[model samples]
Target: MRVVSLVPSLTEAVAVTAPGLLVAATDWCSHPSDLDVVRVRGTKNPDVPAIVALAPDLVIANEEENREGDLAALRDAGLDVLVTEVRTLEQAFAELERVLVDGCGLARPGWLAEAEAAWRDVRAPSERRTAIVPVWRRPWMVLGRDTFAGDLLARLGVENAYAGHADRYPRIPLEELSAAGADLAVLPDEPYRFTVDDGPEAFPELPSALVSGRHLTWYGPSLAEAPAVLGAALRAARG
Candidate 1:
């Protein structure tokens, strides 16, 4: 199909659904392992001219990741672009369904049904504890308001604790996290691997756990299996 993907999760979808069909992708697009064989075009702010010259039949972008200007430039170049957005677990499923059914011409896998059944296995949640998930390092921000991750946590019966913030991922003082009195501050292990051991030493008062970032955050084919996994983790954490 000569697909060029600027977003990582979409890249994962294309690679998983139709391997070797991808012409290029951002440096961040890594999933299903085999996609590692594809050529790296660049990051989210990819070289548009380079992509245009690739002469792709389909270009995948995200409403959240790439800048509007970048996407507009591609549109101006007359390339067919598909933009996906993921803000909730349901929305994640919808996006994946769109990519598979519309983009790749594949049926939704049975894993989604399995994931739903597994979620049904979960006992009705009784609590909504607070947590702060750190998605990045340097300036130090938490998964705040209006993010897919934040909404996923809410689905698991946990609150962002910083949901009313001005930014989806606002850089906050570390001390403010402690003041939030979160039950746990989850540390994601992709984009940066934060281990459970590092938890005690780093954010002492707040019990912590190392988690797969994509599982909780990436909204694509991965969502087919996420609820079962994340639901289990939340059940365990509350125990």
Candidate 2:
């Protein structure tokens, strides 16, 4: 079955589960680092004509990562599109199953089960900390209510300070974020590459947990290692 994945996590999922199934993927689909496929540009602005020309049996995307108009254009060109919505870890698992087993017509992958088992025993730390999680810097967008990353952090004993905001990813002012009464700042390395020098300095007052964006945000094979990887970062930052 020929498939084209627009979401990076889904691209890795499909590539890892069923190799050679993907005829094309977005430029941002960087996992399985050796992935060799037709690059269809970035997730938000994929080359629609290029994707259509590939003649994939199915095109995969996420409701948040991909644009509606792009998906519609593919569907209009007589291609089957599977759009996924992942707001929490559970949704991630279910959606992964939907994409691989149901959508790609492949048997459930063993890695999916291993990923599930990894998070099965994760219990929140007794003393939870509130954090201001930033996804971007110039406009200062943050994790607001009902986000997959926020849910993952909560499971790991960090609560998002802006979880009550109406917007899923609210663009707050830098000054306001610094004053948000959060115990720390949880910075991921993607959507914006937050590094030791770049991000922590912004929140000078709060301890900065520079975490991997893949483990914190991407829901695929990395889920198996996210807990341990993220937990150590948070611990080191807190100490």
Candidate 3:
């Protein structure tokens, strides 16, 4: 079955599970770098006409990464679109199954089970650390309540400082975030590209853990590595 994926994580998921199934994907879908699919543009502004031209049997998208209008446009064009909602690790696993098994009519991939097992093996560190995770820098938005990344960190004994905030990604003042009483600040490399030089300086008082955004925020085969990848980064930040 031919598929067009708009979400980066979902694109990687489908690509890894079933090779050559994807006919096209967004420019942001950077995993499996050898992926020779047609580029359909970015997630926020995908080329609708170009995607329709691909004649895909299924289009995979995420509710968080894609715009409703784009999905509606595809549906209006008589295309079957599968939209996934993943706010936590469990949701990601279940949704990946639904998108692959139910939506794509493919058997469950073995990697999915491995990814689940990897996360299941995670045991929270005895000493928990209060963390403030910043996703962006210019306006300074943070991981707030009910975010998948927040839940992942919580499992590893890193509590998100803004987990109780109303907004899932809230824009807080830089000064406020710096003084939020977090023992550490976790910075991811995407959506904002936080580097050791760029992000760590903002919170000099707090130890900074510069992490891989894909591992920290994305769900897919990466989920299997996220626990160890993020754990090591978070652990090193304390040292």
Candidate 4:
């Protein structure tokens, strides 16, 4: 079955699920960097005409990952679309499996199973609560509760400083953030691109760690190494 993946996470999925069936993909879909990737018109406002030209049997999209208008356009174009979202670990696994089986009819293999096993084995000390702010320095947003960012930290036995903040990606008040009283703050590499030199006042004096935004945020065979990699990084910050 020919597949076109709009979601970047699923780009990796196609690499693992079906060895050679992917026909087109978005620019944001950058894993296994050897495939013939297509030009991205935009993440949400994708080049509809180009995608239609591919004439894929299926398109893997996400409700949150894509713009509603693009989804509507795809529907109008009479193309089959499979939408997926990752709010929790279970939902994450389910969505990926659905993409694999429904889109390619392939079974979840070794790497995926290993990734799940590693996640379940996590058990960090409760005393060292982590304040994982996926630092987007510009416009400065903090990842609050009910988000994949918060969920990833939780698996490492760390608690979110904004665990109860109802919003998914909320604009944080500088004063409130100063008072959040977190032990460690993890700065992720993308969507905001925080670096150590950005320094203290905005970043503060607490223990800091630099993490991969894609690994923590991206879900696929890449997830296999994230739990262990993140666990080690989080643990080092606590110490």
Candidate 5:
């Protein structure tokens, strides 16, 4: 079956599970770097006409990464679109299985089981650390309540400072975030690419954990390694 994926993580999941199944994917679908597929466009502003021209049997999208109108347009053009909602790790696994096994009619990849086992074995720290996770730098948008990243951190025994906030990704001033009295600042390398010299300086008083955004924020084969990878990074930052 010919598939066009808009979500990067979904694209990686499908592509890695069954090579050559994808006819087209967004430019942001960077995994399996040697992927030889037609580039539709970015997640937010995909080229509708270019995608329709591909004549894919299924178009995979994420409710969070993609716009509703874009999915509607694809449907209006008579293209079958599968939209996946992944708010937590469980949701990510379930939605991935639905998209790959049920929707695409492919055999469940062995890696999926490994990923489940990895997460299942993770034990949250006895004493949790309050973390201020910044996804973006300019205007400073942070991970708030009910985010997948927040859930991942929670599993690692790191509670988000703004988890009680109403907005999922809220923009707050740096001073306000520092004043929130977080024990550590969990910084990822995407959306803003926070590094040792960059994000650490903002919070001199708190420890900074520089983590892989793909592993922390992305839900895919990376989930299998995220538990180990994220735990080490968070621990190292504390020391």
Candidate 6:
């Protein structure tokens, strides 16, 4: 079955589960680094005509990552589109199953089960610390309200300070973020590549956890090791 994946996390899931199923994927689908699929540009600005021309049996997308107009355009051209919405860890697992087993018609991948098992084994810390999780800078956008990354961090015992904010990804002033009363800064290296010299300096008062964006954001095989990987990073940063 030829499939086109617009979401990077889903791309990795499909690539790792059923190697030859993907005919095209977004330029941002970086995992499985040797992935040699047709690059369909970015998630927001995919080449719709090119994707349609490929004549894929199914095109996988995410509600948050992909544009609705693009999905509608593909459907208008008589292509089947499967759009996923992942807000929590459970939602991620369910959506992955939907994309792989239900949409791609493949057997349930072992990694999916392992990822679930791994998360289930996670034990929350006795004392949870609040954090200001920043996704971007310049304008300063942060994780707020319902978010996959926030849920993941919450599971890891680092609560998002702006989790009660109305906006999912709210743009707050740098001064406000620094004064958000968070114990630490959880910075991921994607959407905005936050580095040691780049992101940490912004919040001098808070401990900065330079975590892998893949482990913190992407919901695929990386989920299997995310708890361990992220837990270690948080520990190192806090200690």
Top model number, lDDT:
2
Q: What are the lDDT figures for the candidates, one per model?
A: 0.75, 0.94, 0.92, 0.77, 0.92, 0.93
TM-score, each model? Answer: 0.87, 0.98, 0.98, 0.93, 0.98, 0.98
For every model in order, what is the number of clashing pairs? Answer: 0, 0, 0, 1, 0, 0
Q: For residues 1-239, could you state the per-residue lDDT of candidate 5 as single tens digits?
A: 89999999989898899977999988888898999999988999999999999899999999889999999999999999999988899999999899999989999999999999999999998989999999998889999888999999999999999999999999999999989988999999986899998655899888899999999988888899999999999999873
Which residue pairs come into collision in candidate 1? none
Identify the runs in model 6 with alpha carbons over 4 angstroms from their true place. none
Report the C-alpha lDDT of model 2 over 1-239, residue by residue, as the tens digit.
Answer: 89999999999999998888989999999989999999999999999999999999999999999999999999999999999999999999999999999999999999999999989978778999999999998889999999999999999999999999999999999999988999889999998998898655788888899999999999999999999999999998873
RMSD of each: 2.5, 0.9, 0.9, 1.7, 0.9, 0.9
- Where does model 5 exceed 4 Å of error? none
User: lDDT of candidate 5 vs native?
Assistant: 0.92
Candidate 1 lDDT over residue span 1-239, tens digit each = 68888888888877776777788888777776656544545555688888898888888788888888888899999998888888776677777778767876667756555555654555546867788788776667788778888877777777888889988888987777778778877778876677767667657877675667888877666766776677666656542
- How far residue 37's Cα lies from its native spot in candidate 2, in Å, is 0.7
Q: What is the lDDT of residue 135 in candidate 1?
A: 75
C-alpha lDDT of candidate 2 relative to the true structure: 0.94
Q: Give the per-residue Cα lDDT of candidate 1 at 204.
A: 80
Query: Judged by lDDT relative to the true structure, which candidate is superior, 2 or 4?
Result: 2
